[model samples]
Target: MKSFDIVTLTVNPSVDKSTHFSGLIAEQKIRCKDPLFDAGGGGINVSKAIERLGGSSLAVFTSGGPVGEMLKELVTKEKIDYEVIETETGTRENFIAVDDNTNSQYRFGFDGDVLTDSEVEKLLETISNLKPKFLVASGSLNEGLSSDFYQKVAEIAKTSNSKLIVDTSGQALKKVLETGAYLIKPNVGELAKLVGVERLEIDEVNEAAKKIIADGRAEIVVVSLGPQGAVLVTKNEYEFVPAPNVAKKSTVGAGDSMVGGMVWALSQNRSLKEVIRWGVACGSAATMNEGTQLFKFEDANRLFEWLKNK
Candidate 1:
């Protein structure tokens, strides 16, 4: 066993296709240029962000069909260590359109095909073999898989004595908590949905977080509040980490970058407060880039320093 620092599991990965549009017109031809294709999933993005931040992680997920093959090639090109389990159904494709004139973006997504029970078993077995120090379960569950799919992964992580961090929504997140994950990263909207409440105010954020922690489902609850930064809630602590004010760009992948930063900090034995700083910095840095490309290391470094000094 190589004792990897982090192992990321993505159930539904995709080939993200981003194209630039000059502008939108009613019933008019809109030519798209500067198309960019990259392998994307919450976990895959996190792995890429980790590498960019000088951290090490192994990318483990399932890939199948023709899209799967291309995705495998993409990961290989990025030099990311990965284990791909063959499946019967093809992976998904997510589309993003950027406006060159206004520097804005529009995104469209698709749900992935169902995974057979046997395929799920194979993934569970593969996860057993790797035994990474920490496990990050991100993205959505494929069709036919129970909402508790993340819960099962959490069980595997616990049995292997690995810390588990879950980034999911709705019922899937609810079940995953039953398995006792170490951390959960939910944005404001997601947090509201999980608890069946309206949007959360900064004052109410801690209350919502406390409800989840009271059940002993998760040790740490990170509620990302977009431009307002994030709130960290634990049994005995509640702290709000503010984002360094910066010009806003495309908002894609900012949350995932935060996850990557926090996990990297945890791997280095940094304090939770310090991890929050890194996470906020990464998210702020991500807004500096366009489309799906997230946080540059140089920008993240500067933001981290500024955050620490504040």
Candidate 2:
């Protein structure tokens, strides 16, 4: 097997089908346009985003049945290198429909099938064996899988000396913090919940992130403020970058794109400031396209240049 500098793990991968329709009505047949099929899920999408920026990473994900086959085919079409841990149940599919009348996109997501105990063990073994420079575990856990799934991954990363970057929510997110990761990107609301607060405002992001860092949960905590931008907090450094506005299309893979950019930059030994700029740049650029199409290289470069001065 070829060695990879970066590796992404997607416990639950998905086949993303997107299309446009004139309107949304109750119990009526809605005329729709031709569908676009893409490989999706957090880690896979992050790999796609890295590819868009002329970077490469190994994408490791679960596969089963026809949907899993299709997802693999789609990822192959993107020219992404991948490793699949075959399972008994089929991979999930997500539907994204655009209401042309209202210019709104409606996303319907399905829960992935449960993974057997043996399958889970195989997954852990696979990750433990591949000691990449950066290990990214993203997306939600499969049905019947414990929230500590990512926490276990964190432990494997530690043993391998791989810097783990986690992007998840709820119990899964909370569990990983207990094990300690290299970095975590939680939006304002998620951060608030992690710190046991009702809510958090812009001014409170730094202190909240610092609290997590102080607790040894993570070395770096990135608080995403959506349109307002993002803030990066480390043990002794803090950086804030305001988001650059652009014509919006879809936000399907924006967060994944951000993680992709930051990880890629880190692998290249770029400065932390540059890391956040690339993250915001790629994330903002991803909004220019529809569906799970991450971002274009040209757009990301342009945005990065603009952010360099801002």
Among these predicted structures, which one has the highest lDDT?
2
lDDT digits (tens) for residues 168-212 of candidate 2:
999999999999999999999999999999999889999999999
TM-score of each: 0.95, 0.99
Give stretches of model 1 more than 4 Å off.
none
RMSD of 2: 0.7
- Stretches of candidate 2 off by over 4 Å are none
Each model's backbone clash number = 0, 0
lDDT of 1 by residue, 1-310 (tens): 4668799998899988888988888899999886777888999988987888888899987888888998999888777888888888898989999888887789999988999889899888988878888899998888778898888888899899989998888899988887788999988888887677988777888888888889888889999887778888899988788889988777778888899999999999988888888999998898888777888999999999988855
Query: In model 2, which residue pairs have backbone atoms overlapping below 3 Å?
Result: none
